[model samples]
Target: MKSTLNSTSESATAAIFLSAVLFCFAPVCSGEESSNKRTGEDIYKQFCSSCHVAGGNTAKPSKPIAGSKVLKSIATFQEYLENPPGHMPYYKTVVNDKSMVRKLYEYCKKLKQTQGA
Candidate 1:
């Protein structure tokens, strides 16, 4: 009876230890990857909102990104993001990742569709 109790206790401890290890090591478990993930709206609000208002109006003299030729595809969007013409500063760190750029692109597309642009 005592041996049975000991084995059960050992099994429980092992399970807990394994779970902790997995939680620490697993990518999804640690939330490291998802922490960097940004929604399309989030990206736009963070980076482009000041220049490009809702419905894609230009707050300044800059061209509106919504329905712009550059935003037609992710490739053009990324290219413009990296090296835009005129005075717009490069967004290397802000929209560094392709996924991040895609989020911004999707947001622009949605805005264009909704606003009849």
Candidate 2:
């Protein structure tokens, strides 16, 4: 009888643990699912517009992000954002993900193309 009770208890605990794991991962799965739905312009306006407006900001005197050569290369742009040289804040938390980086790069590229830069 004791062995039977222990087995049942273990099963119950395992079930609870599995439930918790699934619950925690649900949001992450949804986030990934919706990531592609966001646009480059939406991402820039939400995250980059604070510091970079109309491509450049007076505070830094840096080149406009829209037409900057670095923006042309996603790898270089992601690297720079990961560890910026100047006063620009690190975007490791925001645009660090591959999807987000791609979106931001495409947005800048579009801006550059449209502006004929």
Clashes of 2: 0
Worst 10 residues of 2 by lDDT: 108-117
Per residue, candidate 1 scores C-alpha lDDT tens digits across 1-117 of 999999999999999999999788877666555625669888777777776777454544346665678877888878888887775667776557877777777778777523324
**lDDT digits (tens) for residues 1-117 of candidate 2:** 999999999999999999988887875555554666778787888788787776665446555676677875888988788877677777764554788889888877766323223
Task: Tell me which residue pairs clash in candidate 1.
Answer: none
Candidate 2 stretches with Cα past 4 Å from truth are: 1-33, 112-117
Give the lowest summed-lDDT range of ten residues in model 1.
Answer: 55-64
Candidate 1 segments exceeding 4 Å error: 31-37, 55-62, 94-96, 113-117
What TM-score, computed on C-alpha atoms, does each candidate reach?
Answer: 0.68, 0.61
Clashes of each: 0, 0
Output the TM-score of candidate 2: 0.61
Number of the top-ranking candidate, with lDDT as the measure: 2
